[model samples]
Target: MAKTAKKIGSSAERLLKVTEALCAEHGLESVSMRDIAKAAGVSPSVIYHHYESRIDLLMAVFRQRFGMLLALRAPLVAELEAQAVPDVDKFLYSIMAPIAFMRSKGEDGAMASRFIARALMSSLPEIKAEVDAGIRGMRETVDIAQRAFPHLSREEICWRLHFTFGVEHMTHWDNERLEIMSDGLCNARSVEESITRAVAFAKAAFLAP
Candidate 1:
């Protein structure tokens, strides 16, 4: 019984991994069950045995990956909630640091980071909701920020958050566009430097009239 259960768990994990890779490469709409089975070294029936459909498998991947993302940011949120005086700089730093670190890693980190970037920026209504629902840390950050600056209206906080996401996407995702526009003076490869500048910029925007 134990061995059978172990095998089941392992296969399920492998299936998810294969699905993630395929989706990362070809995207969710283009990937099929056969594609996943071919990559996982399993039959289509095996995939069905574990997941009801492609959507189910994708949901599993989002839930697992985004759950890890939230866990990574949870300590920051906890520290903020515990503070007698909420510090916006610290809150912004806490949120930006882990994500910047994730971008610094090699291929696996790049893939996960891109996955999250796409999810957050996706225009598709269903995909947007799925991504938003899983990122509890993002919602928490907004609440914490509101408490820290109660004078600001919710609209003001949300507008600032829009710019914050833009900063994170550009800094963390690393593209040549920024460098090109700046005549190679602006480099985004330094995680610590990126977070430092990002927090400062966001702090200014939040405090701006």
Candidate 2:
């Protein structure tokens, strides 16, 4: 039974890796179960055996990538919640730092980041629902934001948080654009700098009236 479980885990991991690469290279909607099977050198039936449908496979990939991110941020987030005075900068950093850490992990990490980027931008109902469900977990962050900015309405805080998602996503996805636009004067590859700038930028945006 242990051996069987190990084999199942390995196969699922292989399928996820192949699916992530294909989805990253050729957007989420463009990839099919057959395409994933071909890339992974498995049969389509095997893919179906592991996942109920294309959306299920995609959600698994989404959960897999974001699960790492949530794990990284969980401790930091808990620390913020424990603080008597919420440090907006630290709160923002807690969110962006994990993404920067992921982006610094080389090609595999980049593929994961790309998959996340595609998932965030996907308009499919299934994808959106998953994303919304994930965002609901941010209630703690929202509570922190409310405490930090008492004057802001919950609606406004939610909107700013949504905007923060855009900034965080772009910082990872189109980071190279900054370097190109800056003519090498700026370094987009520096994870520390990226986190610092993203946190500072988001902090200001959140504080804006």
Candidate 3:
């Protein structure tokens, strides 16, 4: 029974891995179940056995990626909370570091970043809802923000978080835009440097009245 469970789990993971790679290569809207099944070297029926539909598979991929990211950030959040003075800098770093780490991970990370960005801001109602449901990390970040800036209302903290999201999205997704705008002077290719600048910018925005 344990061996059988392990085999099932392995197949499920392969499906997700193939789906992630395809989604990263081709935008989410374009990747089909047949595409994933073919990539995973499995029959479409087999894929269906594991996931009910395309959306289910996509949601599973997003949840797994975000779950990993949230796990990485949770400890940082706790450490910040334990601090005598809530260091907003450290708070921002804790929130942004997981994303930076994801961005540093090559193609799979890029796909996760793009999916997350779209999930947060997508216009498609069904897709947006599923993606939003997978966003525990964002809520956790909000909790930390509220704790860090107790004087600020939730609404205010969320607005500031919006700006921080913009910074992070740009750093991860459209990293080269800065280079184009700055005429090649400000290099945004280095993930560490990009996060440093973004944290600085976002940290100020959060502290702003």
Candidate 4:
């Protein structure tokens, strides 16, 4: 019984690692059960024993990424809730700390961002809810800014709030694009620098009118 239990646990872990590896390499569409099992050094039967279908495995990858993303940014939430960076601009970037964490890392960043983009395009309702809720938090940040500076109209505040998230989300590719655009002339700069420039530019754009 002990040996059997240990084997089962190990198989589960290997299955998970294999799914993650496939996602890292080719995103969801390219990964199949046979491919995952082969890369994991297990049989397709083993994957089936653990998961119902490829969709199940796909959902698992989405869940795992979503959980890690939340875990990465949880500290930032605590800091802001504790009022660490009260300035709206810093606060804006601070909210996207998880993406910055990904950018600071290498393949981990690429995998995370691509997985997120794919998940965004996925039709799974639960995953959609998670993504939507995560995005909706940007509105809360705008509300915070409004509380801090109450002179702006509600529409102005809401639009600026949504714009901040758009800026941050779009900047996820800044490093990837910089590499291509600069032809290796410019190295990957700091996420902070990007955040600073984005937030400053956004503030100018929003507050100017």
Residues 92-124 of candidate 4: C-alpha lDDT, one tens digit per residue: 656555677776678766666667766776566
Give the C-alpha lDDT of model 3: 0.79
Q: Give the 10-residue window scoring lowest on summed lDDT in candidate 3.
A: 116-125
Best by TM-score: 2
lDDT of each: 0.78, 0.88, 0.79, 0.69
Cα lDDT tens digits for candidate 3, 31-86 = 89888888988899999898999988988887788777777778888898687557
- Local distance difference test, candidate 2: 0.88
How much is the lDDT of residue 126 in candidate 1?
66
Cα TM-score of candidate 1: 0.85
The TM-score that candidate 4 achieves is: 0.75
Query: Alpha carbon lDDT of residue 86, candidate 2?
Result: 81
Worst 10 contiguous positions by lDDT, candidate 4: 84-93
Give the best candidate by lDDT.
2
TM-score per model over all chains: 0.85, 0.91, 0.83, 0.75
Ranking by TM-score: 2, 1, 3, 4
Per-residue alpha-carbon lDDT of candidate 1 for residues 32-106, written as tens digits (9 for 90 to 100): 999999999889999999999877887787777777677777788889999976888998887678777666677
Give the better candidate number (1 or 3) by lDDT: 3
Worst 10 residues of 2 by lDDT: 95-104
* Cα-based RMSD of candidate 1: 2.5
lDDT of model 3 at position 133: 72
Off by more than 4 A, model 1: 121-126, 135-137, 174-176, 179-185
